[model samples]
Target: MNRPQYILLPVSPIFIAISLIAAFLLNLMPWGQFIAAPDFVALVLVFWGVHQPRRVGIGTAFCLGLLMDVHDATLLGENALAYTLLSYCAIMMHRRVLWFRISTQAMHVLPLLLLAQAVQLLVRFIVSGKFPGWFYFVESFVSALLWPLITVLLLAPQRRAVDKDHTRPI
Candidate 1:
């Protein structure tokens, strides 16, 4: 039996902004301890960087990082540095990563997330002169674990409704 294919609707820039804003607010919410609280902003930034590289690139990542830095009241460039690197990785692997299913994509995403966290940890260590401990790495793994969910949620608005009449082969 032939299956119907659903086309993607055009994603509006406004939707992207709303998602990033929502992610920022989610990141701001206290999740008991820092280790358990996944960095929603970073995840969303990576998602956009991968899916919409042309629209959301290093500059956007840097600006969002600055905003996050302001929100968290940390060293101004801490997140900017990490996010810039994350965006670079996402953009670099976008085509290759997009070819995989979301579950498989997590394997590809692991290093990028870990690197972003490492940059943040390094920045904190340099300025504060203290190691945050192994628990600090938990958030990166958690962020990777949440990648499939994040991909689904963020892509929901862009999923087009199935049109039966349009099932004819092009």
Candidate 2:
């Protein structure tokens, strides 16, 4: 019997670590209610969803969200649930999303982000008997706005490499 060959994708530990650190920093930044920033952890999950889905999927999202829960001192599993759902959505849509232009992808991601926030709101309301203010949803909008910039910046190196590879003469 002949065995099939399996190819493994390169896992960039440095990139993953950098993404995690960036998420933590973004979370800790003192926005001071000026502008509600996107959940950087969510953004990183989306980045991984599009770029390295196999290595960082729903499990990573759940773990990161749990960490955020501990950090923020919110009811446990609130963000974890939201993040897990978001990661699953992203993973399911990853193929189609990868084909979209950055602008289009931003549009697509907006609803997903909103959905995640909405779920969190529901969970919070159920647990605490109070709903957060409108500003709570602001992060989703801001995240949508930042999506194009993030995608462009993150994918630049890969695009450059692909371009160079194609431009090389036979």
Candidate 3:
């Protein structure tokens, strides 16, 4: 059996920072009242948490969550709590998640996404004493739906090209 091998590409810290920043910007975009924009920053955080736990972990998630909290004008630390838990879950499951195909990985991610939303909802309820209704949970499904796409786009830069010609001194 012939197996294809891939070169290991070097990951730069700057690239990860830029991706997080972009995600934050995306989350900040105005989408009107009708459409509840998905939490792009949280999604990106999970992606990096699973792929590069060492580079992006609990601290990073907490910081991003705080920024998101400020961006959305929500109760402070609400997103931080959710994001911290989400990142911890992702880090713990990173090894297992990497074994599955991107499509299959969504199944693993669905619960986590839901958990993050649930935490956020719980926090909101505690602070405001009101629920945002069923529609508020819609973004969790939307985030899960985009998981495969996120995996593909984020991993694109990290995929090392397989060299066909082997020219090495033996």
Who wins the lDDT comparison?
1
List the RMSD of every prediction in angstroms. 2.8, 6.8, 3.2
Weakest ten-residue segment in model 2 by summed lDDT: 1-10
- For model 3, residues 1-170, the per-residue Cα lDDT tens digits are 24344454766799899999999988888882658668888899889988899999999999999998998799999999999999999999999998777777888887888899999999888888998789887887888889999987887776754554558421
Off by over 4 Å in 2: 1-11, 162-170
Q: Which is the winner by TM-score between candidate 2 and candidate 3?
A: 3
Candidate 3 deviant stretches above 4 angstroms? 1-8, 162-170
If both were scored by lDDT, which would come out higher, candidate 2 or candidate 3? 3
What TM-score would each prediction reach against the true structure?
A: 0.89, 0.84, 0.89
Error of 1 at 91 (Å): 0.5
Give Cα-based local distance difference scores for all models.
Answer: 0.87, 0.80, 0.86
Tens-digit lDDT string for candidate 1 (1-170): 25434467777899999998999889888873634888888899899988999888899889989998998899999999999999999999999998788888988888998999999998999899999789888888888999999998888887755564576663
Better of 1 and 2 by TM-score: 1
